[model samples]
Target: MDNEKVRLQLYMARCGVASRRKCEEIISQGRVSVNGSVVIQPGTKVDDDDRVTMDGRLIKPTRKNIYIALHKPSKFLCSNEDPDGRSLAIDLISPVIKQRLFNVGRLDYLTSGLIFFTNDGDFAKKMTHPSSHVEKEYVVTTKKEIPEELMENFKKGIYVGGEFFKMKSYKLNGTNSVNIVLEEGKNRELRKVFQSQNINVKKVHRIRIGNVKLTGINSGHFRHLSEREIKSLLRDSSSKNGKYNNKGNRHNIK
Candidate 1:
């Protein structure tokens, strides 16, 4: 594939070594070598035949793309490395998988549940794109009771730091918890929403994306996403039905 030579950082990301941003750091650190020469430039290009290594370890993309759903437990970093020696979610993955995998989106160290890992860069990019509008559902337990106005405010929308935040829908759970659905959440949007309203969030656990739910998998374990599930993500994200229908499996994504 010399004709399709790509940048070193992107190649490393495709190999699932890390995100393209992290790969740049790895390259700059002189840890990556291509064809027996250390590569320090992110723009350096490599072909399929080129031998590449990171930290003296071979790094290559696998033949088949894999998509995994992890029931991430709280307190695990959603990264390949943690500076403070904290537990990383990658540590829980088995090595039997053929390729390096990177997370689709991040879950906070204290937030846990259905996070995705994949080797297909295009898939990750497409799924995380704002236009995709991939919905995510979370079960959150707040430290204090929610205000009556907060629910209506969420339905209308809230702005923090000039970014608009709104919930697709929410249902109160007992006295201190609520199940909220989001349409393509921004970084820490949920936290910001609750914190802005002076709510103390005790825990946040993602339970659903598209039609996939965190029911069968145990905490700290992972499983493969079904073909239907994957198609559902691509399909549902484009639907016009702008509301959640947890009662039926035949609902469309909007």
Candidate 2:
């Protein structure tokens, strides 16, 4: 395995620590060591014989990959560390799942919905990559009636701080709510669109990601993704199909 040396960030990700990007952050913080020496460079490479640790804790690549679907509730942070001591969404699964896992993407502190956690770094990269084109569906509720021009402008696309934001599709749920789908879930994309139109958003909850749905799951709870479900997500990431069928068996946390 001498020729198998890889970058530090990629190694951490393969060990189920976190995504490569998050691993890079950890490395920059001087939390990782190679051969007993703290290595802050994310590009540092290592071979099979090298010893690697994080915060003095030995880390090795996990043999079995795990995938999970979590129904996050509002007010929970989707991060490994929070300065304000707020509730963490990952805390809900850590007690039951022994392996080290991290979130694939983030949900706003006040926005709740279906979130994914996994130990497979490659899978995380596949699902969150810009070219994935994976659809994320959300139900947005507003305090006042949604004007026709607001949805029209959103579907047609608009510029927010020089960043263009648009929705893949939308359907009005009521006078003040609508169901929307987005392929590229930019940071606060929905909120920015509504705010641009002077609309006060009351809630934004994700109901689906790719082929997975949040149905039958309660807030702050999680379930293991079936092999087929995992395969479907990876498959859909490369396909152009906008409709994701969710018929996977749900294994709820007892």
Best by lDDT: 2
Worst 10 residues of 1 by lDDT: 245-254
Candidate 1 lDDT at 246 equals: 33
Which residue pairs clash within candidate 2?
none
Whole-model Cα lDDT of every candidate shown, in order: 0.80, 0.87
Q: Tell how far residue 6 is off in model 2, in angstroms.
A: 2.2
lDDT by residue for model 1 (45-101), tens: 887888999988887765677889999999999987888999988777756565578
Give all TM-scores, in the order shown: 0.79, 0.89
lDDT of model 2 at position 182? 87
lDDT by residue for model 2 over 1-254, one digit each (tens)? 33499998988898999988889999999999999999999999986678999999999888899999999999999998798999999899999998888999899999999999999888898788766678899999999898877787778877887888878789998799999988877888889888887888999999999889999889999898889999899888856422222323321100
Deviating ranges (above 4 Å) for candidate 1: 1-3, 7-9, 19-33, 36-45, 95-98, 161-163, 235-254
